[model samples]
Target: MSILPQLAFVLILGAAGLILRKRILFLKRNILLGKDETRNDQPNERWKTMFLVAFGQQKMFKRIIPAFLHFLIYVGFLVINLEVLEFVLDGILGTHRLFAPLLGGAYTVAINIFEFLAVAVLVSCVAFLIRRNVMQVERFTKPEMKGWPAMDANLILVIEIILMFAILTMNATDQILASRGDEHYLALGPLFFSRILQPIFMGLSDGALVFIERFAWWFHIIGILAFAVYVTYSKHLHIFLAFPNTWYSNLKAKGEIQNMPEVTQEVNMMLGIPVENPSAPPAEIGRFGAKDVNDLSWINILNAYSCTECGRCTSECPANLTGKKLSPRKIMMDVRDRAEEVGKSIDAGGPGLEDGKSLLGDYISKEEINACTTCNACVEACPVNIDPLSIILQLRRYVAMEESGTPAQWNAMFQNMETSFSPWKFSPSDRFNWSEKVKEEEMK
Candidate 1:
């Protein structure tokens, strides 16, 4: 047995692993660039959230048709990977069907199931392509989704379709070679889906069938390795991040805005509520909210990285629905983009975040952030529990508090809240004066 294939496989796997390690490290550094905040308070609840939302895909079911199609691809991608494990083992060990003899008849049953899933994934991918291109799914055709975003979505689907085809073709060619008494190939009986494909290769000679089978096998494994590295760069990073993102998701009720800790600390001191940490250094003031990625919390950056660019958030946003410029999906994408830009600059030894440009104004416009109604519709609409509303709120807070760039009307309301403890100009005692008039009118 020549060691060449095993040696080549190890080299390819190693190179892919090294590249992935670097990419993952860069992503982690980018996430850490944000200020730290704790999301570890409710461990048990977090586990449940990850299970139901990420693993079970609970939120996806809200849209039935696309949900079912997505479920097909998701399930198939997972189950079919069992066969991929065999491929990896075989590639490294210089052997084929390592599990076949151990499991006997059950091996064939497993392959049949994998084949079925491969077909399902293939069909589902085609449907996704149609939805993105032919149907031009409204949420998919948004302005932010044009150019590379559109191509990226379609490209991933096409890759899945091709990978599924490779699996089926490899199985079909292998069965034919085994029938021709090829020594290396196994006769795993006809897999349900691949069985129908046998007639196409029946006319091919044993050598040709063997070559096709080997080519397909190599292509499939290499493709899988490539996909692993590619996903880190794609919006499909959500495939892995969706788990942790959902796990650490903001558990507060929709529209239940959490107080910024730094600002809260200052307020508590002002109200004479007593400090929790008297000896500790004073909490920094003035730099209130996020003007760049660094001002946001780590989980906020995680939410950015976990975005699927599905545009459901933007679609459901009341502001966007009413033809406003606020696109929640765009907000998340901008965060991720800005982080990536900063991270790459640091890597290149540039001035990094000090380069003058910021997430505000450069990537995301003040008008877009201001247009949001803080309705939380975007947060509720995310299938993976991403909180674009949180990012939007932070941007708005930065404009209002840090730069004092809010509109005059908003400033007036701010003054009212500070003075009367309400959002109106009326004094507290006269707040219900209309009720007094109503009573007088009724009496008359």
Candidate 2:
């Protein structure tokens, strides 16, 4: 068989994968509605976040075992390409170790290291499955206990298992081939599988060994391609999206919201509010933040594309876990559904209008935004580094600043911020009260 067939196959598959990845990323890039200036506005902070979050995977490691396991998975998946390079050549060109001792033996060492991590990845994946299915970890369940689409959860599990099995199968096949005494053999005894497979392969005929090797090579190659295509359609899409998403994650403080574009006084502000008989329109107003699906910031749409739906954000969210009616997964999913709907309108050249018939009318209720604690746990737990809290803050800014419809409890707080330069509703005159009391009491 010509090596060209397999080479062409891999090249074709790789190009298809790259093209799909680019198209989706481009679609996401153009659909974002909100402020993206924060991502590049501060180069130093963006660099720091990139290094700390993307390179270090800092937040992921908060739960030590899982973090460590993911590290192995991430590093192993990256370097496992060396083995793929070998497999493609051996399978196609009929020569093993085509790049013998390539990268100054770095490739060889990577093979062993990745194999070790492969074992760890399998074990961790199994543990996670059991934790989610059997133990019913709170972090894995839906907020209302209504249960998620089991298909989505199970799809992720199956992908990880297939990935691990493919690694093990490839390593086992390589070891078996090595034991047959082929001159092309590189040392394999050091591999954990070699010791176990040595006695068995030693007894097999050359013809039998060759057939098994061919089968293994085919299985490994086909399995990996299937896995790649499957990932694009699954929640595991974040396996690729998360790193770049986190690198571009919003870094502003919770309350420091983005400003809407300004308008001239003659423009008739006409701030939107569904509430009946609300106050008069302002002197000028831009579109209220997220009044409708179309009004959402472009970054909000990006949040949808980037969402892993791992339920990590929902799990860590105090509001959702406590049953106060908030789920980050649902929020992202809603935004996604709406973005797709609005995107169709935008594509059709229709004006993206927001009246009372808007996304904000019911699903994303007024109560829901105010319910958020702004605790930042959801932001912290998000593997992709999505900041739903930022969206909520921006929504609040619109409600408070434009509509002047601040929630009652927050009304006093906003007033304090304006009058006293703080959210705490206390007189500035009383600021020295604590100092005076402390000094006098201590002296006495």
Candidate 3:
């Protein structure tokens, strides 16, 4: 019935709950306004998705060592919450531990077990930090590599190290309290560092040691709460977003583009992309494709927010490396910016908007769409499995279906699609054209 530990538990739980609540509410509001339904209608697929993305970490494996470290950290961090629960109960309830009974005589054995896991978690995080700092993987690159805030990449490593040390400090304090003596032998994991400082505890009288134990106990709780709040605001927002994005990723079909309405042949439409907007749309077709953020489906917007901005897409983008006017990172940023503009305009009855025209003209340009090779590199590179190809394809549909406009190469390919069932432009009747040479060789 100690009040200090109870207070610490309440503070940690309350702060974590508040941060989680706010994040969930924001995500829900966006989903309701977005196009696709966030709910999973397919039960079988949902289970498959949960296993593959959550348990498997399939996408992360594309880059071996870092992915392996990330997987270990993620799994260990989640499961180690069991150890945290034991601390809270033992610290407050004066109980030996909650898990020991469930785990049998192996209660201390389990503690000894997680002590090793704690060390593994610590080592993995250190490896991750080294990878980000020294190797400078493409995914970790920031605007400034070695300056103030030391880049977000470095900050992430620092946060992880702090959390681990905080946990170790708390464990060391607990050992000192239980043993009522120097923690010389029980030192394990990072607690070994605290063990080396056992001389300080030996120097202090019992009254001073009691105060240190209580303060360290509360400090650990406060640290957990602060980490929760940090997670909500940081680039590590991916910790929250990655799960949902993977659950909802397009698993059923990879190549199919969503259908846009037929604007090209609409009888009443005289001035759309192909006709009225000449230079912007096309002389013959008027207007087509995304003019602004609203023209995009809800899925496109989800892709924007869901991007970890890990730079995986940028690293693999053909247009980005080739010096073309496209970068998937920029595309995601444009979608976010355009969506915010349209939202403000709508809120202000269009007064906040400078132009009366659609968002495509002001936000995403036709040239940006054309820059994409539709190579699926971005699709393959994304750790959370985002499909930039689908977004580009949707824009392609906007152009081909509405404007009746395309590059000469695309036009020829489409013509072949209509006449030959293939993109090679050969007649269907000439299907066996290559067979004649093979037949002559066989006769010889």
Candidate with top lDDT is 1
Candidate 2 has an lDDT of 0.65
List the candidates' TM-scores in order. 0.96, 0.73, 0.71
Better of 1 and 2 by lDDT: 1
**Strongest candidate by TM-score:** 1
Q: Which stretches of candidate 3 lie over 4 Å from their true place?
A: 1-12, 37-42, 87-105, 142-150, 181-212, 261-294, 333-368, 395-444
Write one digit per residue (lDDT tens) for candidate 1, span 1-444.
889989999999999999999999999999999988888878999999999999999999999998999999999977988888999899999999899989999999999999999999999999989988999889998889989888889889999998998899999999888877888887886598998888999998887888888898899999999999999899999989999999998887876887877777778889999878967898666477889999998899999999989888988999899888889999899999999999999999999899999999999998898888887888888999999888888888899887999989999999999999899988898878889888999999
lDDT of 3: 0.63
What is the C-alpha RMSD, rounded to one decimal, of candidate 2? 6.9
lDDT of 2 by residue, 283-362 (tens): 34455565655556666666666776667788888888778777777777666655655555556676543323455544
Best-first order by TM-score: 1, 2, 3
Candidate 3 accuracy as TM-score: 0.71
Query: Global lDDT of each model?
Result: 0.90, 0.65, 0.63
